[model samples]
Target chain A: MQPTSFENMFKDAFENFEAEVNPQIWVQVQQQIPTTAVTPQASVTFSGVKTLLIAGVTAIAAITAAVVYKSEPKLNTLVESKDNPVDNKVEKTVAPVQSIEKVLPELIKENETQKVQPAPAPASTTVLKLPETTNESSANNDNQASEPLNTVTNQTKIKESEPVVEVINQDDKHENNLSSIQNTEAEKTKETEEIKDFNWGRISNTFTPNADGKNDVFKIHLPDANYFKATILNINGKILHEWEGENGFWDGKDAGGYDLPKGMYVYYIIATDTNGNTHKTKGSISILK
Target chain B: MDEQQLVTNCLKGDKTAQKQFYEMFARKMMGVCLRYSNDLATAEDYLQESFIKVFGKLSQYQFKGSLEGWVKRIVVNVVLDELRKNRILFDSNAEVTDVLQTTDDVVSNMEAKQLLQIIQRLPTGYRTVFNLYAIEGYQHNEIANMLQISESTSKSQYQKAKIQIQKTLKAQTII
Candidate 1:
């Protein structure tokens, strides 16, 4: 017989515990939190090819619409730059070549002192040339987006003969802004991708909700395991309990809070992550109440 | 060396600051991990995973509470998570009572290591409730919320765990 119960023994033993932990544990932890890999989790959020395929198909449709609706000045620059042969076939396909010819700089100066010289004579000519370039760029703005930026540089060099290239560079700035918005969206997707599968699998199995604080709650632990539902069934295949969402912590009770009979029960989980990928896991758990 | 400064530096990608911050809490957190685990190896795993999570979610910590308390909470959660993964519950179905002896001595004259050993030998369910309620000073209802069980269940598990631990200590004649 014991005068003191185990609770007193344990509390006294553990209340201020300061045991020597193995140094190797720190090494393992450091590997998971490498300072450099800490940028954003979105890159790894969506796993498998299905999410990528969907994102890709959507991006393709967007590009096609951009090709049809955007302006033609970028394509004119493409026609001018000897560097991109890819745009030649694109030039034929879009066939906005007629506008390109109309907007083409006739008597474009080889180098008109490389500056406006603040003289109205050059300014008037530049004003005349600038509008044509603006019209074509607005027409093919979408295609201009995918075209190598080198074309812009080539335009600056080609049309430096006129003072209007400075105006086009301003347009290029807006395009740069447009592309930056696209980059941030891609970054957001990358962050979601970091919801990659967790290193800890099998985060749940049996739960004895008798609450000794041990196995009282079985949790299905996907990082973003949200918008999901879990169902528990007896051996006879009768559904006993169901929980909605990825916050799947199940106590050993049905929805009514009655103690489930002690036995093996099957659990079925269907979860959808933030990326809309659905995951399913099923298994049996033994409940001891 | 300041807590806020260390946290800020770690957030800024300073590896040295992270190591310093880790060393500050790792020992104490490891102690909490040990009580929830059956062995030093499992305790080490609990410690490792806990720190990794702490680092991962450090941004969410608002610094409104005690830093140690924040870290300790993460350690406790990780231990529970590991227990769930392993499903190491050993349910006690015995319908037995304690054979009380030596009523004058209300305490056990056992070494701390002996106490830990007996605790280590407890079934997962018992040890967990005992650790939470007895050692960690959580109310049974709070434990219920943490573990997703009813208050009655928490109370019962804690009581059973006490009985089991007392039985082990008595069998060893430490009380």
Candidate 2:
């Protein structure tokens, strides 16, 4: 039989089959259809949702207001001190050290002398001045004590040299100040080196290797002697390709059946050393069509 | 009222047309809901939710295609949204790995109802693809786009569903 003839015959049979089924039962099935109520309780629930949304918004606004109120004073102080040149100069020199000290109490406490030495040591050394009264008192005392004297006479000379001893104590205080300054400079240098190391670890280098004469594939130069697992993900955060093998390279095609679209994609690299230390780096790459 | 007049009157919020419209589409859409839902009660709830959403968003519907198709799409979307909210349909731990290879000899002899029953018994990932691709007449690309999966994943899931259905049918006969 032809396809249309067969289809027409099937339709007739199906209608006859439907007619054989009870029309009352079908009507009863239709009558049993479920109804949803938008009652007063549902309205109350909706109002509650509205209240919650309003409360959430109010909370966000209050938090924002609190942050702004907290930061306003510091901002005003900065703006007010912007005009006074001498005061500004002094503040510029001293404020950073004070702020640094305030921010990092442990660092300040750990290297107290280092904090003092870096800024003031050179200035103090250049402006060195000795008190003259103590020098004159010492000379006079030495002249008075001619020969080997009795204990009482020696005591008398020492008493006369009191001013000289005070001068010596003042000199010793200056020397201590210099030592503290040297300590602070050393600590600062050590901290700077640490910061440099941290920055070095964070540095990410990318090279494109598109098989064009120009940079084709994106090459990541991990810091010397760091092993990493590199993963390339599409815009939807789906991992298109992953490389866990010793050689950290991804040709950009997924393990599935198709090539990825040419667009901006994110790559994540997680490096772990034998020492159980881990570092993560993420960046984007562009694929040319 | 006829379907078109019912739709137009329902769009105007006429209670009679609204009731008639619900009566007309509820059963077929309930079947759609039942296929996606975990149970009959949940299916009924989904159907209610879908109708409410359809009524609310009726103004956005452009009359470019069959109204039935548009309504069916809305119902399917509501089911998907419910699945997402319940967290059972797309559990993160459910990973689709290698496709299962099964002999077609068993699948060829299976009836449509038997095939559908087996499809229903498959995992959520496989069942969704089987329903969308095989029954709903969606392409792999469209399924991928709608489900937010790769096209390859959609194909693989359909293949896995077929293999699973074949195996289940074979096992049932043995029993």
Expressed as tens digits, the lDDT of each residue in B1-175 for candidate 1 is: 7799889888877888888989998887877877786555467667877898899898788988888889998899988876666564434344435444431233356655666676665656777887888777788778878876677767767766666566665566653
lDDT score, candidate 1: 0.59
lDDT, candidate 1, at B146: 80
Supply the TM-score for candidate 1. Answer: 0.48
Give stretches of model 2 more than 4 Å off.
A1-289, B88-116, B173-175
The candidates score, on chain A by TM-score, as follows 0.30, 0.29
Error of 2 at A279 (Å): 44
Considering just chain B, what TM-score does every model have?
0.85, 0.79
Candidate 2 chain A has its poorest 10 consecutive residues by lDDT at A14-23
Q: Give the root-mean-square deviation of each candidate in angstroms.
A: 16.0, 28.3
Q: In CAPRI terms, where does candidate 2 land?
A: incorrect
